[model samples]
Target: MDSFDGFVTGLREQLDGPLPGTSAQLTMAPSYRMTPEQARVEGKSCREAGVLALLFPDGSRVHVVLTVRRDELPDHPGQIAFPGGQREAGESLRATALREAHEEVGLQRDRVQVLGALTPLYIPPSNFCVHPFVGVTAAPPALCPTDAEVAHILRVPLDHLLRPEARRREPWTLHGSTVDVPFFAVDDHTVWGATAMMLAELLAVVRPLYPSLTIPS
Candidate 1:
């Protein structure tokens, strides 16, 4: 487990350094990706939100926990996303991330060792400014999704995303505009938009440490 410890150590260190930020996020971003100026010009009031990218280890490989929203959810229905939602009044973004993870996926906050946060992103479609936090659970979590919001729970091996074939693009029409969308294909789910953007930074931070990990293909 030297590699597992290394992954955790590397994550904590990278979070303290200058992040890849929007440049890396934009690599996987769609053409419709909103800019801060546009958000201001639209005069849209956005709710503050937070999400957790929680990692775990199974044997020598590291995995991240994600959730697919139920098709009936009012916002971003049927989309694969990190477990999160708008923060309550007086709640810290970090607390929001931990709390949402617990409520949606039954991940006990006490079990999570939060590393640090990634760059905050604004989602035009949802009108939310999402703060993404990186965290880890020493043992595999007993994750159970709330039937009201979650449709599936995905435990994706992090190394799977490091491969050349992990990223792909497709044409899609959004709000009457056609754009080429880059997304990561996990299982049968298409992870794109703000969720993919957040993952982009997470991957950028984790990518450098892959050479030291002893994961099997």
Candidate 2:
């Protein structure tokens, strides 16, 4: 937890108070290892492309807003995930993340100070390529979730994420196969997969600014 304490202080000092720019943008490409033949055969079965936003609030606190998908959704049903969805016609990946954030949660584009984007990440089970965007919000947001698609909204603190103890690798067994999932145990919830990957990148950026920062095991 000492490492996490250092991380929190560093994040607050670096990003807290007034920021220099109104917004920034980054293009991220996150890769995954999947069976190529299976990918070709699946041809994007349940495959999708989406985006997620990282919002920094007051103090050294950074909040990652995730959603509980409506049980009715055919894929990724009821899972806790970053706010995003499949790309729409004529939409760039950035547009998709922003648009989805607005539709899924009541986050307006105007309120978000988009810092940049991260690499794209692929999910094999769903065959998705997700684009992640990072933003620093000036104020805490009041979320209004669309009841049909979102059941609950989760806010995870960045400080907690940097704690090494909060980090672990969990093994998942599915379809007679096993995979190691990087995870962060926060409160009563677990953050993993693309979400965890994005967090890792975020920590990499913020941790260096403050050397005391450490990502949980």
Error of 1 at 34 (Å): 7.2
Write candidate 1's Cα lDDT for 1-217 as tens digits.
2678888998899998998887778778886664545323134468899999999999888999989988887877899899888899999999999999999999989999999999888776667888899999997899999648898999999888766577889999987889989999997889998888889889888887887544222
Per-prediction TM-score to the true structure, in the order listed? 0.91, 0.72
Tens-digit lDDT track for model 2 on 128-175? 766677665666788878647898888877666667777766677745
**Which candidate ranks first by lDDT, i.e. highest?**
1
| Deviating ranges (above 4 Å) for candidate 1 | 34-45, 212-217
Cα RMSD for candidate 2?
7.7
| Lowest lDDT block of 10, candidate 2 | 21-30
Each prediction's number of clashing residue pairs: 0, 17
